[model samples]
Target chain A: MRVTVNGDPRDVPADCTVATVVAEAGVAPDERGVAVAVDGDVVPRSRWAATPLNPEARVEVLRATAGG
Target chain B: MLDPRPDDLVIAGVPLTSRLLLGSGGFTRLDRFERALEASGSELVTVALRRVEQAPGGLYDAIERGGARVLPNTAGCYTAREAVQTARLAREAFGTDWLKLEVIGDRRTLLPDAVELLRAAEELVADGFVVLPYTTDDAVLARRLEDVGCAAVMPLGSPIGSGLGLRNPHAIALLRDAVSVPVILDAGIGTASDAALAMELGCDAVLCATAISRAREPERMATAVRLAVEAGRLARGAGRIPRLDHAQASTSDAGIPDLTPAP
Candidate 1:
């Protein structure tokens, strides 16, 4: 399936879950600071495993950063 | 209400002893950031959310180690919808609903879009977030933000990172008087005096980032800002002497001794 991860178009498995996409996006499984949003809706950490991404989904994997 | 123990900076029912909030940006290194954070004595600090690829790692852990409440900001988001999405991501990233809402209308000035800001505030408040928006010095807009259920109104001193100090003290003062919530002087603070001036103008607190993090010595600057905040708060309560157009001597004319050289 084709998906947009962090604004970059990529090819991933058809059955990719939120957790899998997040992991593939360079966020280690032990990293708790990362969060995901697919198609503008946040996928809570608890449901990362259950939630599946659709083709052409806009997936955003973000983490806390420094700013004023 | 921040002099005695009972007096604290209470926002959204969370009491903070330190009113000087710091932003985790522009530090040279992690140790310097930690030292500055320790010196700042900021109970609540601001952080930004960015894509994992673009963001530097370990800021969250550093802030956590210092025990400051994480206030995630929508800094780069220009529209209401984008800000709302960023806010949601921030909530999950930081595990805190306290948001420093910034919907910028311009790139150079970095001023908040009052229309979009109000819209976002209404939505976030309804979504159970304690929204503290970074707004202009306009009192009417501040009131509108308050009306939209924002926990507090943070009026800018000047533009973000401008370090220009309070551009319109009157507007800031007017906004302070116009709103019932805490008035935090956010941005464009060049030094301790600016922070002091902000507090003297009746601001509940001051938010400084570049002034501290970019200083030659970040830790010392933090301490300086901390002292400035305290002094400003004290001076505000102490009641400053009225400004006089003419000068007045501390000593009486009658007490003046005789004679200069025989004029």
Candidate 2:
């Protein structure tokens, strides 16, 4: 299935959770400074692991490590 | 109880995950400032404007590296006109309408002049700026500023750089109840506990510099402050139980009261 990741469309395996998408996108599990939002709603850190990603989900990840 | 979430504290509709706001000054190096910002979990950071004499230094880049929304402060202006002009300059330089308006009346104490502050806030609000004035903890002045369309009113806990914490919480509470805008406790925070106390008094946020930058370990202290603000905000939401005049304890019932027992 195709999902938009951080504003760029990318193909991922169907029925993947947010944690699986994040891991597949080459982001380390312990990475800091990345905030994930799905359909304009921020996914809290606690719920990220269990949030299932739909096939056409739009995900935006903001990293505050670079702007003030 | 769960901590107060990001939706609890907001400034002008901007959601802030951390109740602690950082000031981008007093750091020896940009890297240190970056570390401190990350550790502080501050979503809003303040930067002072300077005249572009020779060239724009790396401070802007450093601030960008820290990744927080920048709030440019008008630190040294004395009059309403001067502050308005400085706000324009800051807008042109920083490309943001959000301003931390500081209109000083006296050179000795450097306190904000209530009259000039309201005057500046009125003009700035008219000019389509989000004015956040740093002023004394006066309920009247706070109400006036709010009436003038200020986005927020930042009352100093004490004198700037004093690190004395909230000197007049009663006045702060009055302002909190009077104004509709966010009441941010700015300046005079000495330690993590100080920031926590400010939050416990129902402040929207606390802005500080020396307490974080001047500490022995800025990063660690930044984390401490972040946790402190969260703890205090939770406490405020949880509603502390009142104390009683005398001590009391739960007791077991005696056998003499078993009139109809074992029937």
Candidate 3:
């Protein structure tokens, strides 16, 4: 299946979950301060492994940065 | 120094002693940001959300170590939908509903789109977020934001990072008087005097970043802003004398010797 991760399109294996996609994106499993949202809805960390991604789903992985 | 009135600044039921809200941006290094944050004595600090790869390493940790509560902002969003989505993402990332809502209307001025801002504020408020909107210094708009159940209304003194100071003191004062929620003077503060002026004009607090972070000595500027805020608050409470066209002599004419030449 094809999915867009952080505005970049990529092909992932079938039945890929958010956790797998995150891991494939080089984000360590223990990485702190990261939040993931699928199709504009937040996916809690506990549900990442169970939440399946649809084809062409927009996954936004965000973290806090310095700002005003 | 006089202690700030206990429970004076209550935003969304969170009591804060410091009227200066610092922004954790523009600092060249984490150590300096830490020093500036410590010196500012701000209990509430603002942070922004971005892509994971763009996240500043150790910035959140430093903010935590400084012992201030974080108020994540949707700074770069340009629409109601984008702002709402960003707020949710920020809430998820920070584990807090406190948001500094910003929906930019234009690229050049970086002004808030009042229409989109109100739309986003209404949605966020309905979603149980403590919305503190960054709005223009317009009294009616401030009231409209308060009507949508915003925790506070943050009016810009001028454009962001302009360092032009309070461009419309009357408008800020009007908003301060018109809204029941806290009126925080956000952005366009150039120096300590600007912060002081904002406070003196009846603002509950002043939020700033570039003024301090971009200064040659950020830590020192932070201290100055803190003191200036305190002084301004005290002065406001003290009730300044009314302005007059003519000067009034401080010395008593009767006590002075008659050394002047006879008329």
Candidate 4:
């Protein structure tokens, strides 16, 4: 199966869930302020592990950034 | 016969208990911003997004811990298309329709471009986004924005990040009367007194960043602004008693005879 993380397309195992996709990206679970969106809808942190990934899924993870 | 206490200031169905709106930028650090936000008692705070690197850890944990409604802003965009697209991206990231629309026209002053502001506001409102345009202190422009379905119109007290304080109270007051929607006095606030003055002039809320974030004691200033906003709101609610020029003597024909020793 294939999934896109943060606009970079990559191939991952078929059993991967959204949490697995992020874990593959190397972000630790204890890290804070990270939000994930799949297909333009936010996948709340609590549900990330349970939500399965799709082959054509487009996921974007954003952290709080600085601005004026 | 009497009105109930004013309802919670709701923007796009988000309940904001605090009238003082704080920005999530320009702090000494994220922890500083978080502490200042807590001190201010602000229920709605602004965060910005750019096409830049994402931090290793998430950036929104502290803000979420502050227990405020997260309102992402398009502060860096200069065009309608970019602002609109950013708004959509924010909705996707935060899963909230609330947005702080900022369309800057010039870099020197960071003033809002009224033309692009209206364009972006109209587009966002049509697409089911709760658009809050950071605008100028123009009454005519404010009316036009309300007509376009803006949830709130934020007119600057002065240029962004200037902190020069309320430059034109009359114009802000005019904007207040001219629009039926919430009129937020955005930017140019330097101190707690400034925030109080804006609310006294009938602004529904005040949005400021540098005033508190750059202060010598950021958290202290934040608490001051919070009290100032509340004092102003209470004063407005109490209504000002008109002044009288001449003093009138009190009279009671049946009383005060004893003061003359029955003479």
Candidate 5:
């Protein structure tokens, strides 16, 4: 299946979960201070394992960065 | 000797002793950022959300270690939808509902789109986020933000990172008077005096980043900003004398000695 991760187009397994896409986007499973959203709706950490990604889904993996 | 403790700045029901809010950006190193954070005495610090191509390492951890509350900002978002989504993601990531909303209208000036900003502010407020919008120095917009349940109205003194200082003190003063919510003077602060002037104009607080983080001596500049905020707050409470068109004599004619030449 094709999905847009952090605005970048990529291919992933058809049955991939939110957690799988998160890890595929370079976010370690033990990484702290990261959040994921699918099509603009936040996916809580507890639900990442069960939330399945739809084809052409937009996944945004955001983390804290130094800013003013 | 005015006391700011009696009038603590309360944002979204969180009472804070220090009215100076710092931005955790532009620091060359973590240690320097920590030093500046300590010296500034700010209770809230702003951070941004971005893609994690590379790990942030200890950056966010360092900010947490400083003991100030984290305020995530949507700095790069240009549209209302993007800003709203960013705020939601920030809330989930940071575990805080506080957001510094910034919806840029243009790239060159990095100015907020007033129409989009208002739309985002309204939406975020309805979603239960404590929105503190970075807006222009306009009284009407400040009122509108307050009306929409924003926790505070942060008006810029000038363009972001321009270091222009408060270009329109009167306009800021008007904003201060027009809104009941806390008036935080955000952006375009270059030095200690600029921060002081903001407080002197009756602003509830002052927020800055480049002024301290990009300084030659960030820690020293941080301390300067701390003192300036306190002094300005006290000055405002102390009630300054009204300006006059003509000078007034300090000495009395009756007390003057008759040593002048005879007329």
Candidate 6:
């Protein structure tokens, strides 16, 4: 399956989970501030590994950054 | 989740210690962010949620050390859907439902898109988020935001980072009376006096970023803004004198002889 991870296009094997996309985007397993959202729906941290991804899915791995 | 002291800033039942909600933007380094937070004595700080491209160990560490509650903002989102998505991500990343919702209308103006903002606010509020929308200085729209069960309404004094200060003090005052929720001046603050003016105009609090972060002396400027906020709050409580075309003399006619020696 082809998915966009944090705006980066990536080709991962079929049946990829949200955790696979998140970890591939440089987020550590122990990273505290990271969050994943697939197709605009927030994937809870506990469900990342269990959740499956669809073809051409857009996964956003977000975290807190400095802002006004 | 610190309980607010008596007479403190309470929004959506969350009591905040300080009225000056500082923004963690425009700093080149992490130390300055920490120092500015310290100098301002601000108990609340705003941050944005973006793609996690790299490990943000330093930023989180500074925030932890600063001991200020984080208020995640949708600074760059332009649409209701986008802002809502960003808010969801922010809640998960920051672990706070308190959101500074910004739906930018025009890039050059950096003004809030009223239509989009209200739509997003309604959705977010329904989702159990404590919505604090960054809005325009109009009482009419502020009322709508309040009607949607927003925790607070943040009306911008001017464009984001414009440093123009409160462009319309009368409208801001009107907004303060219009909304029961807290009124926080969100942007366009140039210096300490600007922040003071915000409070004097009846704002419940002020959220400033470039004014303090981009100053020549960020830390000192932060302290100045803090003091100005306090002074303005006190002055606002003190009734102001009515304006008149002519000046009034402080001394009585009987004291005129004191200066008559020159004749």
Which candidate number has the best TM-score?
A: 1
Against the true structure, what is each candidate's TM-score? 0.95, 0.72, 0.94, 0.77, 0.93, 0.93
Error of 4 at A16 (Å): 16
Which parts of model 3 are misplaced by more than 4 Å? Answer: B1-7, B259-263
Candidate 1 docking category?
high
Predicted candidate 5 versus true structure: per-residue lDDT over B94-206, tens digit per residue:
89999999999999999889999999999999999999999999999999999999999999999999999999999999999999999999999999999999999999999
lDDT of 6 at B182: 95
Clashing pairs in 4: A32-B58, A33-B58, A34-B58, A64-B59
Clashing pairs in 1: none
Tens-place lDDT digits, model 4, residues B1-263: 22334656766655677888988667747777888989999878888764224442334667778888778889878999878877877776677788999999999999998999999999999999998899999999999999999999999998888888899999998989999888888989989899998999998888878888889989999999999999988887788867689865567556555555654
Chain A vs. true chain A, TM-score per candidate?
Answer: 0.92, 0.79, 0.90, 0.90, 0.92, 0.92
| Residue B181 C-alpha lDDT in model 1 | 96
Q: Which stretches of candidate 2 lie over 4 Å from their true place?
A: A1-68, B1-8, B52-56, B243-263
- Expressed as tens digits, the lDDT of each residue in B104-141 for candidate 6 is 99888888999999999999999999999999998999
Candidate 3 lDDT, tens digit per residue, B15-117? Answer: 8888999988787688989999999999889998877767756777788889998899999999999999888888877788999999999999999999999
Question: Candidate 4 at residue B70, lDDT?
Answer: 79
What CA RMSD would candidate 2 show?
A: 17.7
Mark the regions of model 5 whose C-alpha exceeds 4 Å error after superposition. B1-5, B261-263
lDDT by residue for model 2 (B1-263), tens: 34556456766666667778898767766777889989998877877654222122455556667777778777778999878866775665456788989999988777899989999999999999999999999989999999889998999898887788889989888888998888889988989898888888888888878888888899998999989988988888898778799966567555556567675
Candidate 6 structure lDDT: 0.88
Give the Cα-based TM-score of candidate 4 against the true structure: 0.77
Candidate 2: fraction of native contacts reproduced: 0.00
Cα deviation at B23, candidate 5, in Å, is 1.1
